[model samples]
Target: MTAPRLKIFSGNANRPLAEEICKAIGVPLGEATVTKFPDGESFVKINENIRGQDVFIMQSTCTPTNHHLMELLIMIDAARRASANRITAVIPFYGYARQDRKDQPRVPITAKLVANLIVAAGATRILTMDLHSQQIQGFFDIPVDHLFASPVFFEHVEKIGMRDKNLVVVSPDVGGMKMAAAYATLMGSALGMVWKKRTSATTVESVNVVGDVDGKDVLLVDDITETAGTLINAAKVMRAHGALSVRAAVSHALLSPIAYDRLKGGEIDELITTNTIPVDPRGLPITVLSVAGLLGEAILRIHNNESVTGLFKVKGF
Candidate 1:
């Protein structure tokens, strides 16, 4: 069997996560410098030889989204120029994914554009998790190892064990019901949803709940949380209608300043999230489960040309 040449690198998007993934994989993060110029242009320098090596660059296009994304693209281009055997862009929380299609007049499919940019930058593979839409995987011409945060949250929550927690998993909007139903099945709970209207780009107002959350502990699940308007509004309504407690499990906890304010103001009891997006609740009652191990294991499997399907078997075990 041929030996594996696994190397991981990171952009400024989430360096801490990259470090943890490197630790789990037991490999030094490939040496690279991702900096910006005076005009905020991205510059990447690969300081090591990755020729013939299987390379994975860990970068999440979170806040400062464009800069981080450009950094990733530049890094991939550099690796390709250096003759790396393969390059995988391991995006944790793929931004620009929400605009996967052009539904409006004279609109651009930004998600497809990002896909083109990555491929053009010479990314041979893609590994991402909890995409806004699973269909986004098909947006890539190359292979996409789409993963989930269920294992991370399930293991952590199951270990602690919820109390009297007959639950109703909640979707803050119609778009998220499928994800909410999946969580309900995994947790052996009921399913519910909040009908919401987007009042603004960062605000969503909950108008009604289609299912029962009354007197039940709620597990509101979604793929992302930006300003927390929708989440907070849902929780507020549930409480008014007799929800015992409103706990949340989001794949990406982008807990913005307003989100933290909402969570701190007694809008949510427990917030379970992954490290896909850097969100520090400043030691609040938020539980952050590291997905580094999950990503690391997947990277190993991909490098060895192994099936990554089993990663979901035991929650990335």
Candidate 2:
């Protein structure tokens, strides 16, 4: 029998990234109308028939998180009702991921709740990147293809010749030590960490550095940054420790107004991140790398029933 046709649709959250992914895959983005009704409720209409075809819907639960999340769920339901053979939710930036655990009294595990919603809406699989916590994958009963932004970051670091510098990969917090260590090992650099205490939801107090950063260029690696509190505090501490320069390689940059102000404070020389969600550099020393090709390749591999492990391989490493 002939293989099912591949169709990729996108919600309003990150249409440009979806378009770029379609470009990389050499396919046109599936036609869809995603909008709000007169009452501001989410609405989705699949313009084309997807019966017996493999369907993928791309959406990032970023700013206006609730609205985007609703759009994704509605889109998935539409595809399922349309009799699509398979439905994949391509969420480059999965929101509510930090709420995976009930850290507070009478709190909810919203991440798991979101997972259940997606599965209930008929998404057979999930394709996401750089979750706040890796264990979030277990929240889903379906297969999850969790991709990392490290390969993309590695290529950029090498291209910019930063890999050859006297570099040390530093985790902005103890919680991110594993990710920092992986980057350090892959880049053949030293590893460091910053001990910090959360002062508030939008602030952090970096207490001390765990490893030597003196006379070395420090690269702080973290999974996400919103108000830029953790990163700025870490950079300041690294500078005080006599580091030559401070840079940050964050996977997702959900920059808020305060984040832009802190980033402009110049504690960090450069901020490197992915276009998982929409990012506006505003002419700062920020570099936004496209993961479209990476995601596009994964989509193709999934449609073809192949392993996506090879995408993790960085050149010359």
Candidate 3:
């Protein structure tokens, strides 16, 4: 028996990342037409034959979330109908991930719903990174390859000499303590957290800090950031507590206009993030690292039936 050929396609969400991934894999990106109709309905047509081939669709459900998500689903459906042997959805940034639970009355778990939609669209596997919540993988009945941007962040942190700057890793909120602790452990830095109360849907107030950060170079870590309220507020609190410098390392940076304004307020000295979503720095102190090599390697491993566990190993100094 022969192995099925691997093909990769991209939606309008993050085509550049997809192209870079293909470059890393040394394969040409599968040709496809993914666009919206005049009525705003998505249309996808596989330009090349993919019958009996393993297919991967790369799309980030970022800004214009619903449109990009719909585009991904449509593309997956197209690949399935093309008789592809296997279909994998590569979502670098999974939108609606924050709505994974029913914290309020009569609200839907949109994250689970999104997962169902993908599986129903005939995706046999899922590849995503730094989801807002870990349990979102449980919503899917298929195999899920959950990757983290920490290793990539760690490499950059070392490159910039942040590892030896009296570094202390702090979670902007209690919910992200685990991720922060992992970074602290790997970097051999002190671990801390900020207790915050959500004043509104878009605002957050930092109540207290859990660990010592005085006179230390603080690094705030989180899986996602949109309005930047939580991070900026936490950085302010860290500075108020006598921290020498404050920086942020977020996996997904869905920076909005308000986030830009807050970032410019100087609470955070540098914002390090991944290119999971489209980010516009607008002349701020933002560093965007490409995860193409990381994702591309994972795609190849998946196609070749290899373990992706090795991708998680970050070299510590």
Candidate 4:
């Protein structure tokens, strides 16, 4: 099959990541103007001709989530109107994923609504990583490429020499057991879980630990963390249970001010995460790993009509 001409663009959200992806793929970043008007409206202009080209717009719906989301929609519309052959929305961090279901009364499923909006805006495909819930893929009618950050995390873990140490993978809550299990299985380590109760939106109370973590180096895995409550509280409980050290590997670290304060309490030794969204560690023991190479490779394969299943395969497993 003939590979289509590829063009990559970036919005205000995480432009550095998009540049890194272009560097990894050995392609020049596409020229585009994504700006805001004085009235707070998003304006997008595709500076280069994308006619019959395969276009990918990279944007993470992170801080100022609605604004970034609107920029992506406008970019998609611009690409479609410019006669692009295929337009893919490369969202490293998919915002609003946590609202995938209608669990409360008089509430909307915002994730589904966002999916509908993307389809309506003329996005032919979606490439995103570490969604808050797996079911969010079903919300889209178009082709959605859901990627995991396990490979990136595993590479870093290996580099940090954590593989040979007596390690235990832990989930901060029962809901994250599947992710923790995947990490434990890949690393050939023991598994543990912290049963947590949410008292409020930003507060989590870790009640107990479920498995053996005594004197073991604990690695807590979670999809995303905005408040640091779950991870910090879990680390505290694990330490109380005789854990030697506690570190967290979260896919998206959308740290707020309160999160920084909680992190300074010294419950966790290190906070490892992906650069899916822009993160400023503020001199903390936070290690931000890049997923650009993974995403760039996936983009190349997708544009060339190749399989991307190999991207999920971990080495130690």
Best by lDDT: 2
- Clashing residue pairs in candidate 4 are none
TM-score, predicted candidate 4 vs. hidden true structure: 0.98
The residue-by-residue lDDT of candidate 3 on 43-108, one tens digit each, is 999999999999999999999999999999999999999999999999999999999999989999
Model 4 Cα lDDT, one tens digit per residue, 37-150: 999999999999898899999999998999999999999999999999999999999999999887989999999999999999999999999999999999999999999999
Give per-residue CA lDDT, model 1, range 165-282, as digits (tens).
5778889889999988887777777789999888788888889987777778888889988888888999998898789889889999887888888788777898889988887879
lDDT of each: 0.88, 0.95, 0.94, 0.94
Each candidate's root-mean-square deviation in Å?
1.9, 0.8, 1.0, 1.1
Count backbone overlaps in model 4. 0
TM-score of each candidate? 0.95, 0.99, 0.98, 0.98
User: How badly does each model clash, as a count of residue pairs?
Assistant: 0, 0, 0, 0
Candidate 2 residue lDDT tens string, 260-284: 9999999999999999999999989
The C-alpha stretches of model 3 lying farther than 4 A from their native spots are none
